[model samples]
Target: MRKPVLTIFYQFNPWHSTIGGVQTVVSNFIKYAPDEFEVRLVGTSNDPAQPNGKWQEAELAGRKLQFMPLFTLQNDNFRSLVPTTLKYTAALIGHCFASDFMHFHRLEPSLATLHWSGDKTLFIHNDIQKQMQSQENANAILWRRFPQAYFQLESLLVKQFNQILSCNSESVKLYQQKYPTIADRVAFIKNTVDSQTFCPLSLEEQQEKRVALTQKLELPANTQFILFAGRLHPQKDPLLLVRAISALTDLNVHLLIAGDGELATDVRLEVERLGLSKRITMLGSVIQAELTKLHQATNVFVLSSAYEGLPLVVLEALACGTPVVTTNCGEISKLLPANCGVICEERTPVAVADALRQVLLHAENYPIEACVRATEPYSASTVVGAVYSDMWHRWKQQNLVSTVQKCSTNFT
Candidate 1:
């Protein structure tokens, strides 16, 4: 029998490098795709070699998955809008023609899935309405300024998808309220990580990693690190983290930031003004291996984001036996067990400082064993692959039943 073909389309490249949680999700979905399916992935590429207004496949000599990209996706200015839209629309339409099942990411390309007469699903990674309030990135600006238009767009788009899988449970409920007709179709599914690649180190290995961390961050060997690994944007609230660090009386506690974004300069300026230059190390964007090491090395992982949708970094850190201190965002509260997490009730510097201080003061209470346990339920291999496979099988069975019913009526 010919296996059902699964085609996934997104707006960013997830196969090559780590960009954010959305890209991470895309890569994991590809990695853990069902055994009975033939998978195809398509995303945007900014490579200069890719010709304009064309969809081209990437060189898969050493790559994990083959990819095709619409070259004009990056520059979203008025001039390139028509060509970019045409390229991705044509590419997705073509892929749909040959596909039995489809998974889509991002808003526009996902909306294009409506053009296809196949089984399709869309995954929600964030609470769009709340994220717009943050105006954290360029994309959020338009939503924030024109709230009515944003709501209309969401109401329209959510109606198109056959099923909507959301990372945050809260987001699922929110979607239910926003679109009552599609409430039954909206479901909660947690984002996952590879626990094997991000597991905790042994005591001796931990000591060595700390020593290595000291050299990498140019800090004291015995320093207790608090790591934050996300874009340095207002939504992530990196500056709030900087302020929280300044509020902390513990001189031994240091913050290691592992990303760069629009607010990078502001973060640097804030760190300098607060005289936290020595206490904070802005590592910028590091590779996944180095980030895994950072997760393994740090005393605690922290996120001061204004909003989220079950962030991957938190799971990765927990999988590496690192405790977390984050604001109540996404479905994060569910992952953190007692003493294994320090969730700030408020999004203030004082609240964050207090949580950080608590974890640093009573480090033994937050054991590596408990931290690792928190991430067990969200393993990608076990959860992501199985979920998609089951969904596709059910949809295919439904289609078969419908076809048989139509045939019986015509024959009679």
Candidate 2:
């Protein structure tokens, strides 16, 4: 029997990039999706050289998957909404006809194509209103002027989709309260990590890897490493981490930032301004393997994001047996087991610095085993993948029943 076609629409291209959380989630879903379903992705590309309107075949977990880049947005900071919507809507209308089920990662891309009918799912990764509010405060006067318009769009999306997938309990609760009529449609599917690859290292192994990484980056030995691995965006607040590091005058610590983004230059300037250029290293956009090693080598992973869905890096760090010091953003505080790490009360530099210092002082009490054990329920193959499988089966059965009822009514 031919398999059902599942097409996903998102903002980032999943070809060979490892920049954003959405891309990581989409890539993992494609990797772990049941073999009985055929998967395809429609997204935007940052590479100006990538040709538009082309289907590229790639293999994941021994299965073939197709990707179509509808448009190229050279500058990542540019949000040319009208042009992006027009080009993507035309591309989706032309190519998405054969899909039995559609999955959308963001609301903006799905706005123009809402007229297309199918069994559709919308995965809400972050609170759209909160994010828009933050954007308006930082930049984008348009968001401030027409905030209600954005809320209306979000409400329309919530009402239109057949199913809503939320990454955390907080989002699920928020949606349930806002759209009580469709509360049953919202489900939680936590983010996952590859447990095998990100597993804890032995003492000797950690020391060896630490030495190699330090030497590779030209840092001294016997120094404590604290890692922050995400885009240097306003939402992530990478400069906060730098400020916290600068305040720790008495500790022999080094901060390693392992990603780049819109605020890269600003982050660098902040590091220099704080006179932490030597104490901090900015490793811009390392591959997955390097990230895993960095997690294993570090004493603590820090997440200073103003908000999030459920960060995959936090799970990955826990899987590697590294503790965390993070703000109470998203469901991270709830997800963290006691003694696995520290959850700050606020996102200020003083709070983060205090949390990091405490974690560093008693780091040995938070065992590697404890960190790894906390992540057992979030393993990619066993837990996360099974949830997706169950969702697909349930939705398919519901659709079948609805179709049968329609036919019966027509015959009557």
Candidate 3:
């Protein structure tokens, strides 16, 4: 009796470098897999130090973590996608055939290797329609029309998936409306947070962690920190968060930015340009453990993304009992409440700054209990258990293989 093989594919290397939302989701599946399943990871070696187009593997959580290295333009422009898709296909040739179920974080890999796998699940972290249009303000007509062109191709690729999951209900609705053919396949599943790992501490613990974090930043004691965690990408707009923080001229306030990507240099320059060198600290590529600490210690968490599909950072922050001030991107307005977090309808720095100021000035309003309670429905135990169990049940019903069909869906 062989356990069913499942390969969770993300687009970044969790083995070497820090990962973003999509990678983190894939990692979560790997982390909480049921004992009856043999979980595997397929990610790209996105670091510069790694060799390009090379197949690499390492052990993660007692499973094989494979890397498909591909180096292209830092911005992930259209020029790079063709070769990137081809490379992903080549890398997944063996894994696709060996695995019973293939779960993908990015569509390009699955689209290219569709013929290689029988059971395919395409998890939607970013809505392709929104992502393609996110940067449409670029100063070219071709760029404006690019989203529609990409969406047309993506529409064709999407119908090939066995399942399409998203955390954002709006994204689910959009998919159902745009492509009714695959409407039954698309469903909204809530994102999960490890409440035990990201829980709030007592007042004394918070104070102690805050003091230590402040010292680590080389800042004076008792500094009020605003934390932003996301990739330095145009969609994330770390620059917007920097600008918002710069406008908060309060001497007690400081901003800590975590994560790294293409716009890292641009964000640094924007911070310097705003004369916020002292007020802002760039904590590049902080791992999940440290990120949980940041969420616990910070006064408020913020996100200024142009678009998203219910960011994991926000859920992690809430689970840590940190109130958030976020622009109404993705499902932020729906995911956050007035007590748990502040949602800004306006996307400008001034508006975001005001939201930050309001949260900072009135921290008592967003109680730690309320913030933590908001995230109760998103507990990892419930959500992850449901995901793995649901998939297992489906696999059994479909009889992907005779051996796996006999396995019970109950957590083994």
Candidate 4:
């Protein structure tokens, strides 16, 4: 028997980029998927070195995966509209028609899959409608002002999918509320982390890492570290974290921010303005190994995002045996075990500061063992790949039955 082909559509090249959460999710899925399934990815790339419209084979999770670039749209703006979208849609339709089943990583690319008559699933990684309302970009502003138009478009695209994989229960609720008719189609599948790579270190190992990191980063000995790792965009509310740190003047804590984005300059200015330059260190975008080390050495991980689709960083932190202080976003509140961390009711600076203060005060109560255990379900080996495999089988079976029904009707 031949293995089923699962083709995924997303804009960014996952093999090349590790910048966004979507990229991370795609990488993980492709890396951890079962060997019985043949995974293929279709996307656009800006890299001038990579030839467009060619299928390239790459190794991920010790498995061979294929990548086909639909077009070479170097500019981000053009990649979504006009001739670019048309060309992409044409290429994607052809690929979808050839594949056994299709998977989409974002709303925009999923739109192209609608043209193909095949079993398809859309993975909701973010609340698009919510994001538009909060973002200040010109396109987001337009969508916010004309939400009805946006909703109509969204509803049309969503209704086309045979199945919708929501990253969290919150997303499933949001989608069901928006499209009640498709309520049965929406299912919650939480994001995952590499537990082995992010597992907690022993006491001696932790001490050695802390001492080494302190010496290398030139930080004060015995100072507590609070880490925030993600893009410094408005949605992430990186400044709110900085303000929260400023409010904790009494505590001997240092805020370590990893990753850079549009608001990088503003974040730096905020740190300078609040006189937190000495208290906060901005380590612009570290690699995965370094990030794991940072999580291991940190006293607590902090995420002050206004919204999310279940951040992988939170899971990564927990897997590293570090507690968290985060806002109530996505399914984070549900995933966090009791005594594992603090969840802020509000996204304001004051609320975040209070939560951080509380967590810092009783940090020992959130044991490393508890944090590690809480993340058992989200490990790549345990849940993510298995859930994906089951979904694929279910959707494929449904598609086969529908095809047989259509044949019978034609014969009659």
Query: Over the stretch 1-412, how does candidate 4's per-residue lDDT look in tens digits?
Result: 5677788777666645635677667777788888778888887777877887788987765768898887765643211334444456666654443476787776656665666776678888775546656654444234566777867878789988878997767678888888899899898887888886799999788888878877876877977889999877666789889988888977888899998766789899999999998889999877787899999988899999877888889999999999999998877877897688999998878899898888888978999999999898888776667766686677578768989999999999
Better of 1 and 3 by lDDT: 1
Give the per-residue lDDT digits (tens) of candidate 1, residues 285-363: 8778889999998889999998988888999999999899999887777878876878898999999999988888888
Best by TM-score: 2
How does model 4 score by TM-score?
0.88
Scored by lDDT, the top model is: 2
Q: Which pairs clash (backbone N, Cα, C closer than 3 Å) in model 3? A: none
How well does candidate 4 score on lDDT at residue 264? 82
Per-candidate TM equals 0.88, 0.90, 0.85, 0.88
What does the lDDT read for residue 325 in candidate 4? 93
Residue 292 Cα positional deviation in candidate 1, in Å, after optimal superposition: 0.3
The better candidate by TM-score, 2 or 4, is 2
Check candidate 4 and list the clashing pairs. none
Q: Is candidate 3 or candidate 4 better by lDDT?
A: 4
Worst 10 residues of 2 by lDDT: 135-144
Root mean square deviation (Cα) for candidate 3: 5.2
* lDDT score, candidate 1, position 114: 59
Tens digits of per-residue lDDT for model 3, 1-412? 5677786765556555454676666666766777888776655654467675555666554546454544422333222334444566566565434367888776666655656656788888765456656662352223345566657667778888888999878778988998898899999988877776788999899999999987877888968999998777677788888888877776489998887766788888988898989899888878788889899999999998888888888999998899999888787777898998789898888999999989989999999999999889888778878988987897786675655645755436
Q: How many backbone clashes does candidate 1 have?
A: 0
The TM-score that candidate 1 achieves is: 0.88
Q: What is the lDDT of residue 167 in candidate 2?
A: 79
